[model samples]
Target: MSRLDARFQIDYPGFRFDVACTVPLEGTTAVFGSSGSGKTTLLRCIAGLTRASSGFLQFDEAVWQDDASGIFLPVDRRRVGVVFQEARLFPHLTVTQNLKYGMKRSAPSPRRIEFDHVSALLQLEPLFQRRVSHLSGGEQQRVAMGRALLTNPQLLLMDEPLASLDRQRKKEIIPFLQRLNQEFRIPVLYVSHDLHEILQLANHMVLLKEGRVVATGPIQDVFARLDLPELVESNVVGAILETRIAEHEPHFGLTRVEFLGQSLFLPQQALPPGAPLRVQILSRDVSLAVGAPLATSSVLNALEATIAEVSESPGDPYAVEVKLDVGCPLLAMITRKSFHQLRLRPGQKVHASFKAVALN
Candidate 1:
């Protein structure tokens, strides 16, 4: 059962935003698209501030609104937390006071979470006495996160929460969000147009275009899919592969990520074997070859796989999806004309060539 379910149709001036999707109870679902794509609008509708002229909104098995008969819950009663692009803390308040504001706001009584848990998760102990205006951009974001989580909401919505911060600040705050998701099991809808953000944190993706939802699913399967070119190569479509560090070759400063226990080397920081790590392999980085090459200068991440399918549209790149017996999959996009030249077909064994730079 999903912890979040929502659908809405809203109009603002000449633009209309229509969205519908259910996200899993765990991990984050990145609502992605261009600035004008209405991703944020859809998020606002779910938050109950930008009421859709009509539709249904449900969270954690409770009906927030249903249109068959008129029913709408005010934002205050929705039990949903929101974190904005800017940390909108009260300037007069200290970090402790700001967080207490939400904790004190919970109805009936504050419940399910403690201020200490959120503080520890976000590393907030050091800033407890600091006024909101005195903190760094990243610290402010963390404080904002603590404020929201302390409320014990059924769902959390973040609308480009990192957009206002510089790259260094954004990088610092990412690990905290990942921890918040896992430690609390909070289902979050993170709206963003940034490719790097989506690749690192999202387990699922919901793509919006001109106010309508064009695609939604697990990041791995969705990245393996075709036709969302607007997203695939452009926004860095890919998945987070979890692997054990097989070994570290000290001389090369290289580490290997194992898929089904086979080691493939890539130059990376040293990590102990049996320690878990993640890798993001992009689609554009992948090139296909018919079989194992006898000799080549390319340090390709060679593996044996049967072509599960080959899709070559007129004038479109000859994109192929290969399935390895190792239980991991790779997606590659090549020129369609190259497909004809190579005489590639389904069920054929092929080498999926990729470079270290391609591994994000």
Candidate 2:
């Protein structure tokens, strides 16, 4: 299992950034934090775009930077592809020319990412002859991504690539970004403050706060902790479930996904059966009952779960966070009133219920 080992210490007049973590070099790992939390700074350090005052960074077996040994690889020598918030395309060049420019700068004996394959992967064929200045925000971003892919990079660095786009444009580019990792097998360091984007794309996460590492691990494990106030404060605390499409019910306009011997119904998805899917159920969306729920209820999901842990919700005297084990771990946020009413405790059995639509 290849991994990225990083340790950085940077100082400015009024800010200090000190972070260290070992991130797996597989799938997408999100560098998540609020604005000014040093998410972009960490990314730039990895990309060799910004030098760390004193640091060490190693990708797998390659030591890109080691100040102790006076070894530091510059940006171009790193074979990293960077996509910024803006497309930053050449106004005078057509999309093909811009894409080819990246291809021409490929690293020696690089993993081959063919120009046609990149064009088709990013759906850039139609706009090949069109000037980048004439393209829409989403189209331009897609072209930018295609150009980056053609560079045959060892790793892809995206710094809020969708931040400048409107909601619809973000939606337009997300699927392509999702496919980039799956198809190219390129490790990605995705930096963003958007929890929704992180939920949708990241398998592993490195959480930052005040320029320091707050949490780091598989998304499921990190979110399951329920002890991080940053997440609780954001009011988006949840569990991430990795499931597979079991079947589709066209008559009911629903798709069934299976995980841990349990099934959940979601609004119809286009992916074929057996495809892997990641589902997020927010803590606030889950409800608990002392016994098995009745079939007469309107709520769509009711799973038998055991109370694994319970703790006071940070900054909320009236709320409590409950950890449940329904084959897979789940987090539920309930009022302190309900906590007393239910007599909840670790090792107690309970049923977790939530509406099917809540997952949407």
Query: Lowest-scoring 10 consecutive residues by lDDT in candidate 1?
Result: 317-326
Superposed model 1: Cα runs more than 4 Å off: 107-111, 231-240, 270-272, 293-300, 312-329, 335-338, 356-360
lDDT of 1 by residue, 54-75 (tens): 8898777788888867889889
Query: Which RMSD does model 1 reach against the true structure?
Result: 3.0
Query: Which stretches of model 2 miss by more than 4 angstroms?
Result: 356-360
lDDT of 1 at 143: 90
Model 1 local distance difference test score: 0.75
**Candidate 2 C-alpha error for residue 75, in Å:** 0.3
lDDT of 2 by residue, 1-360 (tens): 999999999997799999999999889999999998899999999999899999999989999999999999999888888898889998888888898887887765636988888888889999988878789988988988888888888889999999999998888788888888889999999999988888889889999988899999998888888676555257555577888889999999999988788888888888899998887787889999987688788877778999999888877899998999988778898999999998999999999986443121
C-alpha RMSD by candidate, in order:
3.0, 1.7
Report how far residue 79 has shifted in candidate 1, in Å. Answer: 1.7
Scored by CA lDDT, what does every candidate get? 0.75, 0.86
Candidate closest to the true structure, highest lDDT: 2
